[model samples]
Target: MKVIIAEKPSVAKNIADALKIKSKKDGYFEGEGYFITWAFGHLLQLYDAKDYDSKMARWKMENFPFIPEQFQYKVKSDPRNRDRQDGGAAKQLRTIKSLIKKREVDGIISACDFDREGQIIGDTIIENINAGKRVYRLLLNEWTPNAILQGLNQLKSNEELLPLRNAGVSRQWADWVIGINLTSAATLKFQKGKGQALNIGRVLLPTLKIIYDRDKEIENFKPEKFFKLAALFRTKDGKEYEGFYTEGKEDKFKTKEYLDNISGQLNGAPAIVDDKTTEKKRELPPYLFNLSNLQGYITSKYKGWTSSKVLKTAQSLYEKKYITYPRTASNVLDDSLTGKAAKVLEVMKKGLPFEEEVRFRKSKRVFNSAKVDSHSAIMPTYLVPKSLTRDEAIVYEAVKNRFIMQFMPAAEHEETKIITKLRNADMKGFFVSKGRVQLTEGWKKVENIKSKEALLPSVNVNDEVETVKNKVSSHETKPPKPHTEKTLLKVMETCGRSYNEEDTTAEAMEAVLSGFSIGTPATRAETIKKLTDTGYISALGKNLQCTDLGRRLVETFPVKELFDLEFTGRLEKSLADIEKQKFDKERFLQLIYQFTKEAVQQIKTGEDVIIHEIASSKRSTEVLGKCPVCGNGVIEGFKGFGCSNWKNGCKFVVWKNDKFLATLRKKPTKTMVKQLLTKGSANVKGLTSKKGNKFNAILKYEKNPENDYFSWKMEFDKKF
Candidate 1:
């Protein structure tokens, strides 16, 4: 008997069905002299810090940079493991080993997914079991029976994939060292007695850094003044055409004198006609849905659903055989696979928005083998989904449509441009005419896409037109917008670099961009949770704002390292090197360890510090009055008295943090007051104390309106 071990139960079931295994056993399905079993995600994980050494459990500078000589793995335990601490994976491992030793068992088939991680899983399991049986990898591109049978006949020796296994092992160990050491060091050093846990990782830090950098960009940006000139003219057809004033050098109107000159000259003159050009072009249907691309589109266009959510739903669809593999990086299919796409389309023809497109010319746009890796982008299989959850349905539809759309003809259109010269109206000045594709509805002939499709009007330079309206709209230079989830993903994917899709620089960033994207789809949601839990960031609906603690943490760090995109770019390159099996994992680990150590040392010795005074502003004189209790200070804005003497031990802070004080509701009544015995009182309404208790108080105040000073008194009246 031959045994096949799969990555997950879902995958095992698919393989079983494909191999015509009708009979199912307790832990596996058996048929055709084969036994197949599966594993949950990473049934075994690397040892924790304490597992290395008991002393290392408590984080310290000396303990950190915790480079274990040899990494260890352990099985995770459950509640039922009360008596037996051997753990789940260990028990499972033993059973598999026992089965491998059976006289009836001949060999093993590593039927895991065809990815780096999958390779590691099978290799590690076999290594732990010390199984000397002949094993080969079964490389199935799809879960269908035909694909499985083809893969079985052409199985490859697993020995050829040594680099992939090495790369995967290094990736895991590197993440462990970087994540635990940095997270522990930062949490212990920065949080101090608060014992706040700030989880950091290679991907998480870079990801959070992406968000914080975007926030900083929005914060530090100062809008500069620039002017644009728009000229309106009439064609022979009496159609109003808007032309922009063209200059040889001054694309941006920077100087006031330059702006004044340009404004005066082009204010109300007849814009001259210069040139006209038009071209016909075709827009190909986009390639199929890779997991990342699908996630990005959903996050941007739909909102709420994250990349992980989309992946999970797509994976479920794949397991159900409603679609092909969900974890593929390739958007195009193999040449051989393209022939089978028409059959997949036939199964998906009934309800898709692009059903007609599927039945049309699918030869040009269908799956191309050159774009495929171990798996193709997700497409519907022979199995049709009868029911699904709301999000699952949405993701299913997205994948289904993309798969079908890829088989359709390229959407065609004509792009037209018309430029005319106004004779010496100004140097290099011209009135431009523009026209585009005559048919706005033909794109629907391929796919019924409404959102991205552009509609254009047909026009010619000689057509007579008149300017019916003339208007000058004033606009201001705007600061860059704060980081939204949508933009942050893009930044992470590109590692903070800006580029066009086809640019070589942009393409170079793609591996690192997609690889180090903030965090893995699995952990990104949890990382965001940590930021909110630490009071570093808060959400006002979907909008995120830094709290006092959050802002201070950012301010405490060097601006360049904290906010610079180049910093992330360099780190991404290092990470990419690991994936490429070029960079030494140990050196990468050392770099992160040293970085954490330096950051902790910097915070420990508070050199070159800036203090933010509690007072709201220097202009509030009422906050400058002498303190009644202290008898030697002025009442500060939005808080207790601040000492008149600078060099003294007056470290008094009376109000809550900036956030709580900002959200008040009403004024206090006399009955609400009861604080004279302890300190001065005032009838402040709706003011919540530091403990989050809301109350009104009666306190006396001597107000000098001229100087805007107030001194509290222990008296109050019922009405103003």
Candidate 2:
């Protein structure tokens, strides 16, 4: 008998159904010489700080930087609820262990998801069970029977997968080390007597720093005024054309007088066409959708669509066989897919107009063995899903069409540039105008190119056109845009390329790796979403904005490198090296140790004060006003504007983002909450309504006698 372990119960059932092993047992399927069981995602977790030592439980300063001599692992069951563990992961592990120890069992097959985390789950259980059976891995990507069967045919030795497991272990330890040490250090050192936990991490801190920096930039920006010159001319057919006055840096005029002076010169000075240049240009189809690219594309195009949504939709499409694996970093396919290329294209082009045009052929741009890692880029498989939801259909069309466009020809266009010269009583100068005439729609037929550049009418070099009208336009330089879901993902994806260092150690290391990113493509979106859910950031429409809590944490944190982009990039690159089996795991952990020690030491000595967070605190100095119900000091906190009697069961607290003020772009501040508590209402100005009209209203805090959890509520003076 061979025991196969899968990541999830659903996946295990799918594998059993595919292999015809239908005899169901308590926690596994049996019969046909195989016993298949599954883990509920990850059934084990790394040992917490308290598990290493009892002293670490109270989160005291004396037990700072709790770096374990050797890290430990534990079952994923809650410590407080240890008695009930047998029916859960404990039971499943025992079942698998019994199978592994079976006299007839020859070997164990790891049918976990073919990723770092998945590999760790298999490695963890197998090591704990200590079942000396021959271990082999089932490297499955998609859930299809063909994919699984193909994977089963080519089993890899357990030793071959250790590097990936080592990398995963290193990552888990690094995160735990920093999280436990710094969270305690920062919370104890700054937060002092307050019971609030100041959670920190390797990737989470740096990600918050990005939003903080952007918010600061937006806040400190000073808009500058400038002017540009434009000329309006008439064609022989009486059609009007507007051309920008291009003169390099000299184009923008600081003074309106200078622009008007230039405008006066070229108004009606018998201008003759000095040059007319038209060159044919071609725009190749866009690269295929990887996770980040897909997230960026979908988020930008679809208003309500988020990166998480895109990932889920793509994963669903993959399971349904409408598309290939979605959680990949590569945008190009591997040479291995060449055998089924024709059938895949046939299925993709079934009901599309470009069926005859998408001929399958080996192109370096589309398919290359060198560009891909273990997984191929997201593309269509041989199976086409017929009935898809509206969102599914949108994503399906995007991935499929992106693949289809690769086979079609490039988009062709005729770019034209016309220059006119004027010299008379008014001053002398040349004005240039340009446009593009799309000769061939090509790939644009399937892809939405919006609209091609405008086409300019044919004109000779010496032909004179009348100066119909002209004006000088005044403009102001806009501030840097708040990170949209589209831009933030791109930055996070490529941010590992640069960092501040004299020796330039990590940057040099990152140069060897292909794609250096802050977080893995699979988890970047989740990190951003986590930041938002935790109130570190907020989304207005599609734009990501840093909230007060997020900004404050980034600003208050003492260790700058903890939030440094370069450090993150280098660390990520180091992980990639570990994955590639090029970097030493022991050496990487040593570096993490050194960094953590220094960071904790700095926090101990450094005097940057932590927020006087009143969350679960008995008292606070940053009190705004007297609480109406409890007559205690109403204090400002990370999550809400609350009363100092919060520890004594006072529930008169208004959430920072009380639902009443969330849509109005108003985060409840100390002042706002104070007024609601003391005066029964707080008058707010410039509150943007749902229809986008700005209005003012008085916000009042009210408590209900009916509910226990949701006792505090806010009501506005007006209906809106």
Assess each prediction's global lDDT (C-alpha) against the native: 0.59, 0.76
**Tens digit per residue, CA lDDT, model 2, 1-720:** 899998888778778877888789999999778899999877878777787788776867778877899887777854434423424777788888898999999999998767778889998998889988899998865777777777878999978998889888888889889888998888787764454477777888888888778878999999899988788877666666667765652567688897688777665656777788888988778776677778888898986788988988887776564677787776677887887766777766777676676677778877876767557778877666769988898898888788888877788888888887664535444677889777877788786565557857767888878887788988998988888877787667768343311112444323423446777777888888777766678888777888777777787788899788888878887887898888989999999999999999989998768643644544347778887677989887666777788756677777776644766777776667667766877777888876799887776666555454443343556554
Candidate maximizing lDDT = 2
lDDT of 1 by residue, 1-720 (tens): 988888888888888988889888666788887888776656666777888889986667667567787888766544333223445566666666776777888888888777667888888787777778888888765677777788888888888766567657766776676667656655655554433355555555455555566578778888787665565666555556665544653445565565455556654454434445667776656667665567666766664555556667777776676777776655666667655776777776776564565563435335455435446666777667778877878888777767765555556666656554443345555444445553333334443565343332345554433333333334568876665454555565556553222222535335533454444333445455566655666644334556666665566533235344556555555654665667766686667556655654554454444322222344333433344435455434233334444234343333322222233333232222223222454455655554677766455544445544443443335672
Q: After superposition, how far is residue 629 of candidate 1 from its true place, in Å?
A: 55
Candidate 1: segments with Cα more than 4 A from true spot: 77-98, 194-196, 226-241, 248-276, 346-376, 416-428, 437-447, 451-469, 498-506, 509-720
Tell me the RMSD of model 1 versus the true structure: 13.7
Displacement of the residue 392 alpha carbon in candidate 1, Å? 1.9
List clashing residue pairs in candidate 2.
496-569
